[model samples]
Target: MSFLDGKSLEPRDEAYRTHEITKKGLPLSAIWKGDANSISQLTVFRHFDSASVSEGFIGEGPNTVWVIDYPTLERIYYDLVVNFDVFGSVSHQILTRMYMDYLRMESEALFLSFLPVADREPILKHWYRGALAQAKVFYGHSHLLIDTPAAIHYGGKDPKNELIRMIGTRSMRSTHSARPTTNYVPSDLKVLDNLSAKKSLWLRYLPELSYVVVHDDHGEITNVISMVVNRAHANVSFIFGEEDRRIPEEDTLMLVNGLLGSYPNFIFWIDQSEIGKFADAAKQVSDTKSMDQWVARYGVRRTDPRIWSVLDRLHYYKQHYYKQKDGESEGLLDVSRYENL
Candidate 1:
């Protein structure tokens, strides 16, 4: 606490200020008001349709759940943000990053502590593919971790995946005391979950971010999902020449419910039945010409007449349904940054 006593954050808006409670920022409002003692007291619920998601979301499972326990949280704030200088020298930046790395390693180790001890090393190995052997030792054995055995009974040979399924099962709650925080994915959209790395080789060609819409028999938008392509790396040990570490074969596709990004590389629309056929068509592409044809069939190209209409429909869905499903509405997606053929 003494370390952060001199530091203070400048308030740019009414959201972070001690103001009258509004419809937005209900979670932070609870803490500012007398309703909640801490942020932990406020219920936070999230739904992830895919295991392959952001490191912040999945860490390396369906989601990353780190046990910060107040002290670590305070340290993370002071060490990562308050202490980091944007206008400082290169050495200052590198030092801050090194401190953050050590913190991340410890936090990740803490997350792994929640899983069965036998499963810990293997998951650690997968998460840190090309790290030096000594770094692995510190992350695994040397770190101060939660020593108690995991309370949950894990199933299957793959406990990491099984844990994700368990969390998903628990979140299918019909009722919760706290207000729901985000878009409730349509149960029918579960079809996309079946597409895996083993079967869906076409996933390699997909862009980093994609907005996909599936239509019903009447040509009405039945479901909206985001396909996030996660590229695997050999290591996080360098800030320079990072591209050399790319291992495309190890990449994974994440099917996220609703619109996930502001600027999607492309938007693909297809009927429910055509999804399999679409995958097959994409999988057969041997060159750019074939790839272009596949895009012509399934994608809403920038030059297409239907592009604006598709964007409008997506925006409409976000406001009409998501505003209530989640506590807040996101800003409009700007098409100027979107990729085209």
Candidate 2:
């Protein structure tokens, strides 16, 4: 007889013998109730711990009256207990974006990459799925939540400011919206020599991106853009490398100065501690604009109404090292701390 067919037989009947509940000499009445007939025919197995129970089949409880197949139930239960956060995050991304679009509002986009060792492949894949889910959420809201692989025009058509083509993927070819505009090689002589005259080194290995993202690793990605930027020899370089990579603080000053002419109206964010260095660099480049004056006229500080109407609202403020007021000493705060005007 089929096991399920046998299950239909009455548990109290002679054909289906019931096992007595016992613990030493005591009856398991608390769980089974006082009447012997009330005891369930289903075996009462004890799990070693919550983990074992958690790994059990998914779907509604025994009494809920549902019909989920075994394989599906098992998959659901395993995901619920072992990777709940990832599943929930992905679901939330989709649902929340839908809600935002229903309200006809744009949602802010965020991109995140998770890095984990090789041994934790399952967990890492879940993170990648979670990121895709987040992207979908933003897309649902009628907002574009694009991944880094997205290619489009970042600069105008003017030859002086056209989009730089990092010499890597032709993926942008598929994305007709952002065609190859400019070579955009950096002006710095040193970076050019280092990169072997490659104007667009970032495109060299699009295949690697697939695996990196699939594996949910970001170490390679973190360096790609910076590597591309360095090749162009731009005055202001955003270099990335292994953890031991040195950020060239001194040369950064030169690049910031060069940006003054190229991107004068642009606002920026830097660590509060680094603000002084950037300011000093600006001074060395041009004495006409002091930090306070620049903050008052062109920076985000200007638009702030609480303290001094010092900053604009477009650029979001973030934390940085800082000096304390009242001769307190050096510390850190967001630009808002100074702008709370």
Which model scores highest in lDDT? 1
TM-score of 2: 0.19
lDDT of 1: 0.57
74-129 per-residue lDDT for model 2 (tens digits): 54454445435554666564543343332221111111111112212332233233
Name model 2 segments beyond 4 Å from true. 1-169, 178-246, 250-289, 306-341
Clash counts for the predictions, in order? 0, 29
Report lDDT (CA) for all predictions: 0.57, 0.23
At residue 51, candidate 2 shows an lDDT of 13
Error of model 1, residue 91, in angstroms: 4.5
- lDDT at 205 for candidate 1? 65
